[model samples]
Target: MGFLMDLIGTLLRVNNLTYRYSSQDRNLLEKVSFTIGLKEKIGIVGPNGSGKSTLIKILVGELTDFEGNIEKPKCDLKIGYLPQDVSRDSDRILLEEVKAALPEVYKVEKNLRVLEKRLENDVDTEVLRDYGELLSKYETIEGFQLEEKIKKALSKLGFTKDDMKRNYNKLSGGEKTRVELAKILLEEPDLLILDEPTNHLDINSLEWLEEYLRRYKGTILVTSHDRYFLNKVVTSILELRDGKSTIYSGNYSFYIYERNLKEKQAWEKYEEQNRKIKKMEREAKRRKIWAKRKEKEKIGAKDKGFITHRAAKLAKRAKAVETRIKQMIEEEKVNKPAVEKQIRVKLETARHSGKIVLDVCELSKSFGDRILFNSLNFTIIRGKTIGIIGPNGSGKTTLIRILLGEIPADSGFIRWRTNIKIGYHAQEQENLNMENTILTEVKRENSDETFVRIVLGCLKFSQKRVYEKIKNISIGERVKVSLAKVLASQPDVLILDEPTNHLDVHVREALENALADYSGTIIVASHDRYLIKKLADEILEINGKETKYFPGSYSELKSKVEL
Candidate 1:
């Protein structure tokens, strides 16, 4: 929600950069050339294993079997790289770990001060030389208040000064990413390459990071699945595919619009070329037949020599026409990129339930001495959507599991309406078999072949994709496959726990559309504001020992809460 730093100019230029890993048969990056302008934010987007990570590694000087020159602004152009998966050894305190980034500079300052104190006592030449070099290097890096700078960065990233003393090992995965990000920001690198920076971030944290990056005055190259984040932060889109990067000006939406237009133009050209080729071939055939007949007549009239020459010339002209049409088709094909694939699947609840889908009485759950929820009561009616929302530690998920009978409550009475079929998407992987294929999983639940095909089709699964092993699929695909199974069973009630994870914005929008049009009862525990706003007919605010219900949408609830 802040103005992005404007592009100042090119800070790092990569020229004819070609690289292939030791095990790869072909070049991972084939003579790719691009420039990261000063203060510009570029997003590198592509499917997995499309060389996004490998390319970033090369840029940061991590891997160096490269065939091209990387022209940096300066020899010591400070570069900070944030990799995916922030794992920390919990034993080290946070401050100690972050301070390690500047240990050499810190040591130099200490030695310089010591040398200064001993100057009156006749310091050795070696000591003075060492002291002078250290002083110069320290000043060059602006080492005067490096600690204060580190603390400031960390604080902005959501860590308090008190948190600096906590052990890194004790922090969660999200916390570790934040700490690592803070360290990178403190380094004040001229170029920053972030890979999936928003992976583990919550909505609040994600917003904060977006604001932080918007204000950052350095060149950034980021790859993320968050469309909102991409549109908010990226100035341009760099699509990496087939060992090359293509630049598209403007934001992600602009890129999509441009790409769609390109595809449409290509399709139109392809059709036009096909029609012309067909017409040309037909005319060439008819002319050859007519010429053959004429040549036969000429042969009869003793003019065979002239007829042969005319026939050869006509054939050559036809061949040239065919070649031109083929070339046009190929030209159109070359620039076309594969668009997003959608999986379609339908859920048929074989059995229908009574009006009341779920009945709960005095549900109480606790973990050890900590009571997550106490004396919670609720009811879910058919043909209604109830959204469960609260802080991360709240028992939204716990309540859903208890209703599904997946987890037992310490004290509760949950009664399902008779003939109630349930389609549940659990937060944990209990309902999924990683070894099964997408089709197999759906088939197991619903044995009808026609039904399975319809369901998979509805979820946007193509015939080829239905055979893919579940383990090999992306999380978004897996979620769809899971939904397909639920649909196959035709449950009267659907209970979902954070169903939006691993979903792209497009897929999420599609899912929202599907849910909005569904007739069955639905209950979901989620923190996605967009989803809650678009889908929820009622808000069930779950606080400890209490569940409050408010009619209308999340907007209405927010308005009331703010008041």
Candidate 2:
């Protein structure tokens, strides 16, 4: 990986790393080599099934039977790894859990207490030395202000003071992830490895994390599908493809540009090689023709021998050229770049809804005393993409459900015009039937098997894949199934809740393009800023106290919020 880039302050080195699952025929990671720098913010990027998770697992010493060497510069190096799935089953409160993040710190603190107690009785040389050494260790680990640091981190990560007192078991999945993340940040490991860390984070928490990571004094190796997050946080990118690592000394945007440039250059070289091969073949054929013509000519009987010799030389030269062409084909040919996998679906909407698609008046909703949103008033026009954004518990889903008439608003007027057919794509893909095959589920959209198959194909579902049950497929494929269903419905107003969740960058880009081309009113409630910015013309920002309308793109809304 350091073939061209500077390798200053390298923290860890991965050399000739290769791994294969027991059931797999081919190695998932093949000779992957990369150098992680000290205090460097680097990102790991690849498409799904590119062995990103496998690589992380190997790096963290989860799978030991892999062929590779991971070199750590420091003997006592500490690493904090955050995987996609986190489960902490504990009865302890938030503060206690975070405080106990580094159990070694507790040991240090306990030793310091004992040393201090001994100082009260014995003031010997050995005792003082031990105490001084322990104190230095404590300070190095930031044990003195540990609690304060934990509290500050918790607050920044959207944890309330009351939440700190709440039981860890009581917290939701996202809340638990936050608590876990805060603990990791507080612990301050020398090397932090984050895998899909932004999956559960809200927009506010994401912003906070970006800033925190920027200021963090630890080396970070993070893998995420969030391009925006990678762009903001990572200084360099390490892209894994075909079990190999390609390094880029810049963020996600730079990586994209470089990757494209490299692919273009590769294509150019391959085409040039093909052109040269064709030219050589043509020249050899022309020489052979010339030799045959010279041999056929019986002019100048005296110079007949000379003509034959000339023909023989020309034939020999042609044969030499043919041999050179064969050697070039065997040795000097450039491999063509593989075609990228991308969904090629077009979402078309029916023009059946009225001019005023939806009108909400004085929408107020509260669970007990906690008001989620109050006095929400807005009118959604036809053929406009509206982005609904809010915090985790700020009623974005509730508002969406209310608009879809799945949930009742406390005091609101949801006026839908005539012929307004609603097509909803839920975040969890609840609309899909787990027991049903993908083909069966998609067939529900269109009874015609031929049409359904075509749609599924466009969504990157092969003929064999269509028969697979929904539960057997990956979350990303399930998302595509949901899209297929939604497309078949052909609703006038399309409502997608966190549509980009669990999607790879390529699929997300495809979805964005389709949604952008959709002429119907698109209402999307998502934490995906990239999707929102690309699609939304206006924003419905639901903060618990007030549901405000920002009549601009997500970037404009962000600027206003910053102001």
Candidate 3:
């Protein structure tokens, strides 16, 4: 761990940090303290709204407020940070943009090579010194083979060399992220901070990024939902909980192990202390009874003052011990339960009337002559959970809208069962009633007042929450309310669009389990691989006018698609 020690000695340190947003009720980061060692890869993990992104913002000096101190080495240590989204110039070629990361380095390398050849046999001291100086500058920038490094970085991120010549704006979101990642790698910073770096990457590209991060010389702090990537790249994990940071010595897997162990130990200690206090209290009560009996017998001992005094003293001592025992019993510490509640909907949906709930025959959809789906045909059946997954703008949302009868297919026939009832959890449904109270919104969805309360209760919304306006609620709470509306409908078929957007991992798991137990047909469009794996019985992948269906979970789809 030589690198660790060196990093501690002259590296980046954040001391007694605290940050608060003006509109927020509490600090986003409070008294957070951690150090990033040179060449150490750290993963910052937390549930949503746990200050992960805020911490990164603090590191990059994006949000400056009441804080403690940030220390770094006196030397010029460059840092490169990659945001979750990349806004690149669409008019410029991706390769040309990536190459612009190190213009000075390239120029220095060019000069060094020219000098080396010019003074090949001059044997002049000044010429040699100048060439050596240029070479030093080039080496400092890692410019000896810049093109080769850029190519390698891009290729590892699942982008071919030909992709580099494409216009940045013409590329998809995933491609833009890859190009941005390549540019950051070319910068060769001493420290790198990446926020949701895997957001737009596929399985192959994510794995490539993980491998590249492992071999990278710079220190890295990454925020990501890709558990596999975290387990692979990070040597240490920094978890933000309740506006505080907890550092784990190992990777994400090890963090879970240590957290569970600590919780178990706390619970055991709490139970043992409670038991000891109860036993001590019982013994004290028995002693008090004996002392009381002795006092009653001494009541008639008028001549024996000494006996009376001794009896009185014993009673006093007994009372003091009893009081101490009572205090001990009442002072037993109890730990908070290390568990969370999730909204679980046991959807009591009716069976579909026909075997084919929905059948699309030669379906085609277009927007301004840009055909999204051309001659697409698919059959959705009862008791099936189908997941539509693809990159952004791949017509997954459009297809869902068409099936739900919200939009018309350009040229196709959509046949449904005789009396199919549809339940939809629209992605933007939460935005429908910003001015209404939660109770009002639910009542609007379904007029049954008691059922509205029951549904909200199931979603973990309290009575106080019901009275609160929708505009005042957090995004997660609004999402739950939207989900509550869907549950209240209890339709024959459910269509959920990116349902995991604002939910925590626990809630997402709850939804997955509930969906698995549901008996009716379900169609969902989601990018959450973890959720899709658990709930999706089949996967329908839409790629640029071609639709492919694989009969299994997302993992199975990966195998089939790769084949």
- Residue 21 lDDT (model 3): 85
Q: Which has the greatest lDDT?
A: 2
Model 1 gets an lDDT of: 0.76
Ranking by TM-score: 2, 3, 1
lDDT of 2: 0.85
322-392 per-residue lDDT for model 1 (tens digits): 67767766774444335555544444455667778878788889999868777777777778899988755
> Is candidate 1 or 3 superior in lDDT?
3
lDDT of 2 at 51: 91
CA lDDT, every prediction? 0.76, 0.85, 0.77
Residue 95 lDDT in candidate 3: 63
Model 3 Cα lDDT, one tens digit per residue, 331-371: 75565555454445566774446788888788888889666
TM-score for each of the candidates = 0.74, 0.88, 0.75
lDDT of 2 by residue, 95-160 (tens): 888877778787898788898999999798999999999999999877888878788888878787
lDDT score at residue 234, model 3, on the 0-100 scale: 96
Maximum-TM-score candidate? 2
